[model samples]
Target: MFKSKLFDSIGFIRTTFLIAFFILIFLASITYRHIKELDKISYSIMNTYEVSLELNQLISYIKDAETGHRGYVITNDSIYLEPFIDARENINKSFQSLSSRIDLDTVKQKQLSRIYDLVDKRFYYFKNNFSSKTEFNNDFRNGRIVMDALRKEVNKMLRNENKLLSSKDRLYRYNNSNTPLIIFSTFLISILTLGYGYMRVIKNYKDLMNQNIRLKIFDESSKQAEILGKYGSWVYSIENKTFDYSDNKFRLMGCEPQSFLPNSDNLLDNIHPDDREIIINAFKDIEIAETFPLLRYRIIKKDTLEIRHFKTAAKFFTDRLGNKNMIGTTQDITEDFNKTQLIKLRNKELEQNNKELTEFNHVASHDLQEPLRKIQTFISRIEDKEKENLAETTKAYFEKIQEASNRMRILIDDLLQYSRTNRSEKKFELTDLNTIANNAISELSESIKEKNAQITFKKLHEVNGIPFQLEQLFINIISNSLKYSKPEIPAVIAITSTKTKAYEKPKLKDNSKREYIKITFKDNGLGFEQKYAKKIFLLFNRLYGKNEFPGTGVGLAICKKIVENHKGYIFAKGKPNEGAIFEIYLPV
Candidate 1:
């Protein structure tokens, strides 16, 4: 609505200019009128000033004349008479000027006439007294009365003129103050109005230019995207048997952009010999199909002979004249295809290696166990037969040999369990961890009894996991707590479980959006430092010497493998002489 009223009237720019012009003209006219008014008031005040001066001069002359007359009558001095004479002439001249100045005021003119009459009477009385002593005595009282009346009249006239002067001066001052204010107000208003209008006009124009520039930028960006994305658009006109490929399409074929018009023969020539028949069949089928089918094929670059993968998708379109056309995009998928192939190759290689490793672990454990068992059996027989007769050093050496064989046996057993944890059948079942923890405790009954360990657990959450592995996970952690208990302190192991979100476990880097069952194995055992939390899970990693803790350091490694095979995670937290907590997360 504002645009219609302003812009449609005379165009926005022109209308704004016209409005500014008129505002300036209006301001100038107002300023001129105020100045004229100020000048008029000033002139009137100057005239009033002259009247005030005249009134003061008239009073001064009257005083001088009275003094001269009094001095001449008392001392009879002619020198004093000169002053009196000059004052008399000056007094009449001042009165005449005062009368002319006050001609515009009838009341003031009347007051002046009365004052003149009283002065004339006082002059007559003084003239008669100046001549005779007896006449002076008789007329002295009347002369004093006339003199008093003249003074009263002059005072009245002076007061009236002063009031007139004051009124005119006030008017002049008012005009003087209002003139500048009026001019400044008008000028400021005009300038502000013009500034606001021009600013809006400029802003609108810039906005329009920016919109146009943005549209051009978007168009350029779309073309640049097609080129940088290694894709190009094409339109095939079936009626004319002509193919129109974009500039990028030509470049994708290893020809100069827009070098030549493309046709079916040219496209087929670039196709790999193995995929040529497939494209030919697809093209023939699309001629009758209602919807276009996606086609993938390989093409050989004309200049470099380099093979490139291309995928094309088109839609069937009919023009107004019923001409059949196909519009499609062709993307160069060489890089993506190569990456996919490499990933597949890596996955196959990893699968074969894992199978070989699993087989080797089982075979090695099986083959090494026979010798280990035979050595242990022979050592046991030797101890039973000669331990009593052997010397003390020989007896100690025999005991050490038995201890080494036993350790070797345990190491092979633990190694087999660690490998089997990864190769075991991974079948998920809804298993209650309360049952699993109880089962682990049952398996460690002998150790728990020896240490007087108090193993505590509550109603735990059930989760989807491999049940046997979950059982083994609890056994390994609880067994560690039993083995590492502080001296003279009964081992206290607490097993607790709760339903929790994956994000709550900061150490478990997995799918954080899922829910999991967090089972905590907290124990008051001889805990290690916090820094060795991750190190403890590594295979063959031990925090204490073999003499201090008896086990191949592969127990926790087996526990980690079991949890991972069940798609879960385990981490440990420890503080010296305080306790250790082994936290496990299994998806629910």
Candidate 2:
């Protein structure tokens, strides 16, 4: 009874196997047809690539020949002419190669024949023109026209070849859809033949489920990270060779999700106009090195025109298909950039405040001297009349008080003038320095005569500055020169102006446009050492003591402030006992 049952099961199994085998054979026939179609398409594609390669070579040869021709013409060099001949010969060879590869399609064959005829005609014409000395003009122009026509024909053929290549690519892609179906059917038939196939199928199903779950988790984590960090991730598609950005990335770019396309142009358009070329060059560098580096740039928002700073770290990823994908994170660093700018602004503000305070101290001290001087003079007048009536020690004390008051008054006045030097809120007007200088000299005419000082001036320029301030500047400088003159020598002051824009500090103004001017003041007096060049521009900074030269040491400091307020700079150069030169650069 058991043998009979086993025979019966074996017979049934054989019948089932026969039916499955027949079905497989039927499917195999259909798969074979699909595969044959794919092979034909692939062959067509290969032929197209061959034609394209040859045509491209031909185009390159022609360009080389043209370049060589121009070079030889420019230099009249026989060496360059040899290259031109070589390139021309290679052009013919490349055309022959293309011809052998391309099939006899009516449109392509016609275009190819026309190209051959034109090439031959141009070659003959160019060869004849090579030795012709008859003022090569109109004939050479005709040759160019013929060559251009030939190039156009070749281009047309290339386009046709590209179309064919595209067609083959599409066919192959469509045929590929049947491959997976055929493979799955074969797998199914094999599984049906194996009795333990169900166990394998269940295992594969479980593995697929786990893989999908992991993929989902990864995606969720990436999205969460992007949102929290205000960063966006991007991937490049190998098939399309295009960039794809995540939704978060679109948001970060200040663009709609649908509008965001990962491309060089789109990204560059968002960059600050000034920084666009810089960012583009950086991207090219990465592409050439096949490396990814962190890039920072400013992006101008499209709608709002608000600028935002962004930082990105990018690297190229090659997929299994050997296609490049650029993956990176984009982050907004606008706040950080703004904070840096704000800190710089605050530092500048603090510096300005400190300068203002110094000026105020000088002015306040100087102004107080007037009242103090009045007090001292009145006390002296009263004490002078009663001096003999008092004790000898008392009279000496009164004389001492008078001397102290006089010194104090001088100190206060000097401080006051120094503080007010460049702090006045007066508008600048066009003032001629020559006129101003003469007027300043006239005001000090008595002093100049008394000291027997000689002041000379070069033709001064018309500059935009306050007249009063300029007058004061000249007065202080001239007074210093007279006070520090070499003993027994007449004070000689030489003022000259040079046309210069060198080192002119740009003015901070609402308008973008402005002009500039330059002037210099040179004096022959008791000059100090070069080491004190910058130190001289400080309050109470005197190179000599009161006994050597009487000054509150505020003149140069006031000069520096005035020059700076005029959006100019002042620098002094001198040697001990030599003359001093002060150069001022101003933006008008």
Candidate 3:
């Protein structure tokens, strides 16, 4: 539709140009005719004015000569005859000038000739006066009659010239009036044509710019796709025996783009010696095979001299002309391949480290515990035996030693337990959480009773987990609530469990499509600030000094490790003086 509209608009513009061309031609012709008519009228008007002026001068000169002749005849004065001589000199010149001017009109020319004859006859009468006064008067009267005839002839010529001037003036006025309209019409047409052409040019420029922008966007999208996928495309024509590789393909091979045409030989030359055989065999079998699975190999980069991995997949297709061809995609998987290798190496290292740690734990457990236990026993004995005999300062020092010894023992024990979590065999079993909670409470009975703690729980769902670890997890959490209970307020810890999908719990950070048991432990205890929630789970990380709250700080860390062993997560939410909650998620 757009294309059709564009063509239609172009057609309209062309038609408009053709029409404007004819308009200009017509305007030009009309203007030429108007100018020609104006020129002719101007010429006629000039001739009429010239003829009128010359006829008036001739009449004046004739009247002057007649007056002077009359004065000379009356007084016979030579001064009076001066006017006659001057008039004679100028009259002939005026007559010649008038005749030349009015020559274009034959009627005017004849009138002018008659006027000249009458003037000449009047001058002859002035020059040759009759001897008698009567003859002179009679001759003067005849000259007056001739003068009247000359006046009528001059008036006739003037009238004829006036008519010509009026007619030419009308023509000139008509042409002058039309000239403005013609010029305005031409200007309007020219403006419209120029405006239309300018609009077309602007429209074409905008369209070209828009098309350029779209092409650039498409180019950017293509380049982004190549970069994101770490892959490039290629085609091999079997008939022509030519290979075509994409720009990114050359870049992936650590070579500058467009350096050279890609061929099977150059490609194989870059392949590692060990993988070259595999690639060669794969291509050799392509003619017989319809398709193949992904082929992976390694190459030594020319620029960096680094070994890199590449993978490709190809399929055979027949062109419309019945020529066989292969189209394929090659990906630079070096980063991913290197990451996998690094992970394998890390896992091996971790395994070896874990083994060595387990051995150290076993040795330390035996070697350190016996000595620590003996020291605690010896301190207790000394505290009892020398309690009354020692001075107050000595007794205070003994208490310090005893406290240090006790703390040392607890540290060694907790350290041993924390290590065992990673070293122990993961023996998973289906066990009731309620049973686990009851066993944990039973083990912490002394602390619960001392704190007057109210531990509440209902029958919880059974889940797949290590039974001993789950029990230990509950025991540590319950013990924490009992130990940290605010003074003068009875401790209250509520245990609850609900079945839910893993994704439903936002804090789990597990997106697996599996069900889980969300077991929560809420307590009304002297909870630490929420900021220390994660820190508390780290081994030996304590929020308070030993004088304020005596602990190894390894209980929560052990709980975290145990939960991890069961493929679960445990996190805490706490607010000072408000309360604390520990949420545990175990896959069901």
Best by lDDT: 3
Pairs of residues clashing in candidate 2: 362-415, 366-412, 366-416
TM-score of 3: 0.50
- What candidate 2 gets wrong by more than 4 Å, as runs, is 1-245, 249-374, 388-397, 503-518
Counted clashes in each candidate structure: 0, 3, 0
Candidates sorted by lDDT, descending order? 3, 1, 2
Model 3, 134-159: lDDT tens digits are 88778878888888888988898789
Q: Compared with the true structure, what per-residue lDDT tens digits does model 2 show for residues 88-109?
A: 8897787777767665666777
Stretches of candidate 1 off by over 4 Å are 1-219, 383-392, 505-513
Candidate 1's error at 91, in angstroms? 99
Clashing pairs in 1: none
1 against 3, candidate with superior lDDT: 3
Error of 2 at 359 (Å): 8.9
Q: Is candidate 1 or candidate 3 better by TM-score?
A: 1
**Model 2: C-alpha RMSD to truth?**
40.0
